[model samples]
Target: MDYYDTIILEYHNTILDWVIADKTTPIENLSVLDKGISDHSVITLEKQKPVKRTIACRNLKGLDDRNFASDIKKEAKNIKQLDTGAMLGAFNSNLRAILDNHAHLRTRTVTHRPSAPRMNEQIKEAKQERRKAERTWRKSGLMVHRDIFKTCTFKVKKN
Candidate 1:
């Protein structure tokens, strides 16, 4: 009798299609309540919809062994055989090259990517600037000093 019941009866087929596409089980019975207590009519639909899950992965490639081998061989030749420090340095340099190659493989080759500045160099520059600013502020009269008082308001009063 109400508008909701009329709409449900008219578009029952379309509603069924939406329910089916959403993986909701079809309702056995639909009822319209015309209880005189409430002004608005109540239409009850009984069904359960299944939950859906999605999965995604990043497209990343591993480092090419040929390039890594060539870099290691080139770096290894520069070291003198007799010196232990030179051999260790060469080994460290080769290891760095391999790590750099792997890092390149994980990142995307895009023109819009912004390069990051060296963190240690930036920190050193910031510390230098802070020291310079402090020196300048100390030379100026802006720095203030206050003496502590025994009867300060911040101290709690004893009963």
Candidate 2:
């Protein structure tokens, strides 16, 4: 009976939608909302928990190093006929394919993240102003706009 809100169903004098939790539960801002579609109200609460992020990365532990080296050597011999830029492209593509076959990528979630306090409203506005100035300079191709863009960039960096 921790909920202080009024009953959800006025006619029935009861709360049909509700949450039952122990006192140790880490939640706040619990409330009942009326969405107009259903007679029972919607229960909502905010959990006090850190954010989590997932990132993909190669699993180097399972890599076949010997086969990777041999594949690179074989691909390099076939790229001798290409120009410098094409040779670089072939080398990159071959290397990526070899790595993919050896160390396949895996995604994992990261937890207990710290919020970014430095990237506040002021810093965000400065970065946005810098981008706007850059776009205007590029479109106008004028010296004044270019100077303004440079100044904006300097201001953003200083902050």
Candidate 3:
């Protein structure tokens, strides 16, 4: 008996690219596999380089901690007194101060790194690996055994 045999390959190349890029921006080319033969057909794939973006750092200084704390306290008092507008204004001022302080502390100069491919490359590699595994299973007659294991059941006795 003659049976039609076919193989379908699908993959996302970003994951592999991310792995190769070391989880950094501007990922680079990722070479995973070469030409290979399967039970049905051969497969070939390549990963492209990733793109980088520029991130800017804004300077924030002159934030007074004492003033921030006083504002917070005043806002709390206003809130207790049911002065909604005043409380909201004070709360906004305090929040702005805190954010400014944090920005000042965390500020850093922007740096550009070489671009590399994103996560899609890695996904494609994974899919190719899966296809290879399936082909290997078919060649080794292991798929049938795996199915048997899936349907297996064992009776247990209570002690």
Which tens-of-lDDT digit does each residue in 99-142 have in candidate 1?
Answer: 66554424333333223333356556555555555565556635
In order of appearance, the predictions have TM-scores of 0.24, 0.39, 0.23
Minimum summed lDDT over a 10-residue window in model 1 is located at 145-154
What is the Cα root-mean-square deviation between model 1 and the actual structure? 20.7
Q: List the residue pairs that clash in candidate 1.
A: none
- Which is the leading candidate under lDDT? 2
The full ranking of all candidates by lDDT, starting with the best, is 2, 1, 3
lDDT of 2 at 144: 100
User: How many pairs of residues collide in each model?
Assistant: 0, 0, 23
Tens-digit lDDT track of model 2 for 12-120:
3453554555443466787766789877767778876766889899978777778878888898888884488888988898888888888887799999654464667
lDDT for model 3 comes to 0.47
State each model's CA lDDT, in order. Answer: 0.49, 0.77, 0.47
Best by TM-score: 2
Candidate 3, 1-159: lDDT as tens digits: 222222224344432211322333332332344345432223333434444455556444555667667766665565543577876776777676666654543544455554444335555565555555556656778867445433331111110
Better of 2 and 3 by lDDT: 2
